[model samples]
Target: MSKVVLITGASSGIGKSIAVFLVQKGYKVYGTSRSPKNIENYPFELIALNVLEIATIEKAIDFIIAKEGKLDVLVNNAGMGITGPVEDTPTVEMKAVFNTNFFGAIDVMKMVLPQMRKQKSGFIINVTSIAAYMGLPYRGLYSASKGALELVTEATSMEVKKFGIQVVAIAPGDFATNIAAGRYHTPVFENSAYKENYQLNLDVMDAHVDSGMHPDEMAKAVYSIINVTKPKIHYKVGDFMQKFSIVLKRVLPDRVYEKLLMNHYKM
Candidate 1:
């Protein structure tokens, strides 16, 4: 019997790539998106879903359960990025980021766990980012959101291990995806706090992401993990610099690591 996999944020980038790859591997892939029509003629079924919408999330899951009878894998890949100084970022904007990136994943997990428990087998992969481990200049909000997700995945993995469900996080370094272009930026008050460093931080973050790794690589990494018999709790995927960044942070002193990042961003 073919395994059924559900992936959120399937309209583009890594999600789209994974959906296509899984379909090719003979999995029954149900890819969810806010606008399924925009991704017409895809290999898998595209279900309309907006992760922030509770009703839509429930409906989408129910639809899949009715059609497939079992959900073997759930990839929580939907998220947004907010780039600006943390102090200057609006509370509303920060909430929006968490709503989609953190709470959205948690909601989906809660909805799917009952089914997975009954089935006695399933995998939940949360697509986090390298930012989860390291803070960037203007990406504090985005980083914090992903950081929260990392902790969630850590605990969820242990909680569900006895039930034969695997929960893992994939932290991909800078990926050349719509996320960078799709990032929301709000104006900071020139006279407000952190003004002196706000624009500088924003520019640095923009340049770094613009030159990040390609999304297809991240998709490939996701595909690899889904097949593992005992997948690691977390997998880091990115270019040399990203991998190095992780290592440097561990070995170097806090101030030294900060200096390296500052130099890398030319701040």
Candidate 2:
């Protein structure tokens, strides 16, 4: 029998691409989104799920369990991006992004983990970003959110290993998608000291993402992870510079790596 998979944020972008790819490869895949009606007709079933809502997440899981008899894998890919000067960013905006990016992913993991524990086997592939390890100038909230998820991913692996559960976080470098369109930007203050430089770097951020790698590459990475029994605890996909940045941070002194980041952003 084919494995059963549930992927969040499947309405579009990386999540949708992964879902479609898995379906073509014969996995029984269910993708989730706030508005499932728009993409429910796709090859994979699109379920209505507002990750911020616990009850909806429960319902989506119950729907899968009822039909599949057991949940085999979960892809916690639902998330939102926030961009702005950290000091100028509103608390409400930060909470909103955290609600979806951090809290939402945690909730779904909690819900699915029980079933995986009961069955004695399961896999969770978290869709994190290359920004998970470092904080970006105007994208601090987004960084913090993914960073939080990465911490959870690492800790959860050790916690769930006895139950035969595998938790892997894939840090994908920029993938050309609708992430910018869906992102929430904190308002820039008129007298803000960081306004001018913030705008410049923000535009650079947008252009960089606009020319990001294809989502198909990320989908394939996820596919490879799922097929393996002893996959690594962490995975990085996309540009060599971004992946190498992770390595550089480990080898270089704090000030040296920090300087490189500042130079990259022209801050």
Candidate 3:
């Protein structure tokens, strides 16, 4: 029997690339997006899903189960980016970011795990970001959200190990995706206390993202993890910058690392 995999946020970017690659490699891939209208004639199934919507998530999962009869993998890839200072970002926007990035992913995992436990086998890959490790100038919310995801993946991996289900997280750094373009830039402050500094930080992040690696690299890493016999709990894939950032986070003092990151963004 062919293995089945469900990927969210598949309309474009890394999720779409993974879906195409996995389908070509002969997995029964189910690619999901908030709307399926724009994506057509794909090698595998395309389902409509908004991770924040419980009905949509349930419907998409039911569709997959009815069609495939077994769920072998779940890729919690649907997420959005919110960039701004922690204190300056609106509470609503922060909640929205967590809704899609952290809680949304958790919802999918919660729904899928029961089925995987029944089958006694499955893999869940949470697509995280290197921002989980390093906090950038205007990306406090984004970084915090991903940091939460990393912790979730780690804890869940251990929890599910006894159930024959594997959970893993992929933290890719600076992928060339629409996230950088589509990012919601919240006001750094309502009082305009740091407008000039905030704008400079945004510009710095914009340039860094513009020069990031292509999304296909991340897709390839996803494929590799899915095929592995014993997948890692966390995989960090990206350029030298990403590795350096993670290393710094591990070895440097919090204040020292903050200075380094601040200097990187010229803030």
TM-score of 2: 0.97
Q: Write down the RMSD of all candidates, one decimal each.
A: 1.7, 1.1, 1.5
Best by lDDT: 2
Encode model 3's per-residue lDDT on 1-267: one tens digit a residue: 889999998888889888888888888899998878755567667889999999999999988898778999998999999887777778999999999999999999998988899999999999998888866667888888999999999999999999999999999888777777678888656477778888887777778778888888888898899889998888998999777889888898999988987777777
Q: lDDT per residue, candidate 1, 39-83, as tens digits?
A: 557988899989888899899999999988999999999999897
Query: Model 1 residue 257 lDDT?
Result: 92
- What's the count of clashing pairs in each model shown? 0, 0, 0
Q: Residue-wise lDDT of candidate 2 within 146-211, one digit each (tens)?
A: 999999999999999999999999988898998998999776678999988888887897898899
- TM per candidate: 0.94, 0.97, 0.95
Model 1, position 25: C-alpha lDDT score: 81
Each model's lDDT: 0.88, 0.91, 0.87
Task: Give the Å error, residue 34, model 2.
Answer: 1.0
